[model samples]
Target: MKDFIFESTPKIVFGAGSIAYLVRELNILKKKSAFFICDPVIEKTIFFNDLSGKLKKEGFIVNIFSEIVPDPDFDSCDMARDAIVAAGSDIVIGIGGGSAMDIAKVAAITAKNRKKAKDLVKNPELCEPGMPLVLIPTTAGTGSEVTHIGIFSDNDEKLKTGIVSPYLYADVAILDPEITVSMPETVTAHSGTDAIIHALEALTSKLATPFTDLLAEEALGILYRNILPAFEDGNNIEARSNMLYGSMLAGKAFANSSVAAIHAFAYPIGAEFHIPHGLANSIMLIPVLKFNLNSDIEKYCRAARAIGVQTTGLSEAEILNRLLFKLEFLLDRLKIKRSLGYYGVTESDIPRLALSVMKVTRLLSNNPGEVLLEDAERLYREAM
Candidate 1:
C-alpha cells in the first residue's frame, strides 16, 4: 500500500427521523437565517413544507431557491447563488439529490466570497472559504453530502466536469433514511446502482489505499445485498437505512481513491443525451470491467466474493463470468436499460464520445488499466 491521506466531512448525523438535527446544527453554527437550495420537485414535498414551516416557527427565517435543474449545471448554481445573496442567508442548506446538494455547494461559496459561479466553475482554485454549509440527502445516491467534488453539466460543450476542493466539504451532513422512503422506484434503482458503482470503481482505482479498500468492500456488500429489497418496496426502512449508509461509505471511498474508467465513460453520455448519471454508469459498467479484467485478476475475484458470488471451485475467468452475470441479473431485476442505443446514441457518436472521455485525465489516471483511443472506441461500441 502506498502512503495515503484520507479526509471526510467534519460532522455526520445519520438515522431514522434525524432531519430534526438541522436545528441543532444551525444552533451550533449560531445561524438564524437559512437559505435552501433544491429542485422544484423536492420543494413541493410535504416533508419540505413541514420542515421549512417548523423552522420558521422556531424563529429562523427560511428562504428557498427551488430553481435547481437536473444534471446540476453552472446555470443552476449561478441562479441559486443569486438567490442566496438576495436573501442574505447566514447559512446555506441543500435538500434533495445530487443536483440540489451540488448547486448549494457552489451557491454557498459564491455567496460568501462574492464571486460569480461561472468564474469559479472555470477556475475552482479561485474558490475560497464559504459560509457554514449543511447538506441533507433525501435520496440514497450521489453521496454529495460527504464529498468535496461537485459535478456540472456543460450544455454548450456537451460534456461533464467537476470542481474539486476541500473548501466544498459540508460543515455538517444529516442523513435520515425516513426522508428517502418517498423515492420513486426508478430513482431508487438508479441511485442505489450508482452507489454500487462508486464502491467497485473505488476498489479498483490505482489510488486505493488500505483505508479506502476497507470502506469500499463494506459498502459494496451492503449496497449489493439491500438494493433489490429497497427497490421492490420503498417503505422498507431497514433496506433504506443500509442503502443510505452504504452510499455514504462508497462516497467516502471514492472521494479519496477516485473512480476510474467506468465513471469516465459515464460522463459524456450523461452530459450529451441528458441521461441520468446512474443509468449511464449502469450501461457502461460491464464493458469497462471487461476492459480492465487483466489489470489485476485477484482483486476482481476478491471483489466478487465480497458481493456474495459463489467462487468456490471456480477458475478466475469463471468467477469473473459469474460476477458479470450477477450484475446483469441486478440490472435486469432493477429494469435499468443496458443498451446505449436505447438513449438514441448512434454509431456516428462513438468517436466524439471516446474523444471526450480521453480528456478526463483526472479519472483515467486512476483506472486500473490503460485506455487508449482505440480501447475507448471499442468500449463505447460494446456498450452501444
Candidate 2:
C-alpha cells in the first residue's frame, strides 16, 4: 500500500436516460448559456438536434461549434475557445467522443483562463481553472468526461501531446447509455477496446494503489463481459449501460493511477498514421502487455482472472498465456486490426516511431516495467 489521493469529476449522473440530467447540472452551476461542442457529423444527427432543442426550449441560450475532427488539433481547439468567447457561453457542454470532449475542455478552460490550448500542453502546471463544463458521451468509450488528462495532436511536432491538470476536470459528467445505443458497430468496438486497455494499463501502472486497483478490476470485468454483447447487438440497452459504467470506472482509476506504456506506444502511431486513438491503443495493447507481464506476474495474473479467465491451478506463465489468447480472440471477434503491418508500418519505420514513444515520459514513467529505447523498438516490432 502507498499514500495516494484520488480525484474525479464532482458529479456523475449515470444510467440509460441520464442525458436528461444535464439541465439540472447546468441549473446547479447557474449557467444560462452553453456552448455545445461536437463533431460535424454529430451536429447533423437527430440526437444532437433533439438534445440541443431541449436546451433551447428550456430558455437556455445555446451555441454550436461543430468543427472538431478526430485526433483534434490545437488550432481547432483555439477556434473553439474563440467561439465560446463570441457566444459568451456560461458553460461548455461537450457531447460526443473523445476528440469533441477534448476540444470542449480546451474551449472551456481557455475561454475563462486567458490561456491558449498549446500553453496548457507546454506548461500544464500554469493552467488555471476555467468555465464549468458538462460532458455527455455519445460513445461508450474514451472515458474523456471523467479524466483530467486531455490529449491533442500537435501537427507542428507530428505527435500527440497530453495536458494533465486538475483544472481540466469537468464539473458534471453524464453517462447515458441510451445515447450510445445508436453507435455504429465499428465505433462501438473501437471505443470499448480503448476502455479495456485503459483498465489493463492502469492495473500495472507504478502509481496504481489499492483504490485504483479495485475500480480497474471491476472495470475489467464489466468491460470484458459487455463489450462483445454491445458490439453484437447495439440495441441491447443492458449491455450498453454496463459498458458505459465500466468505461467511467476505468477513467476514474486511470485518472488517479494513470495509464502506462501501452498509451505511450499508442500515441506515436496514432499521430503518424492518422489512426483513431482507441484503435491505435488496441493495436498496441497485446504487445505492451506481453512485455509488461514478466515485470509483475502476480498483478498480471489477477488481471486475467478479473477479465473472466478461469485460471485456477494454473502457473503464472499459463495464466499470462491464457490472457493473451483471450485478448487475441476478442480482437478477432471484433475484427480489430492486430498488425501494424496491416496499417503499412514497416521495420524501417520502427526506429522513428520508437523514438517518439521515448518522448512520452508522462506515461512511460508510470509503466510497471522499465521501458527503454531498445524495449520500445522491440515492442513496436512485435506489433508489426
Query: In candidate 1, where is summed lDDT lowest over 10 consecutive residues?
Result: 116-125
Can you write out model 1's per-residue Cα lDDT over 339-382, one digit (the tens) per residue? 99999999999999999999889899999999999999999999
* Full-model lDDT for every candidate: 0.91, 0.90
Q: For residues 61-133, could you state the per-residue lDDT of candidate 2 as single tens digits?
A: 9999998888888888899999999988889999899999988887788888877899887787776688999
Point out where model 2 deviates above 4 Å: none
> Candidate 2: minimum summed lDDT over ten consecutive residues — where?
119-128
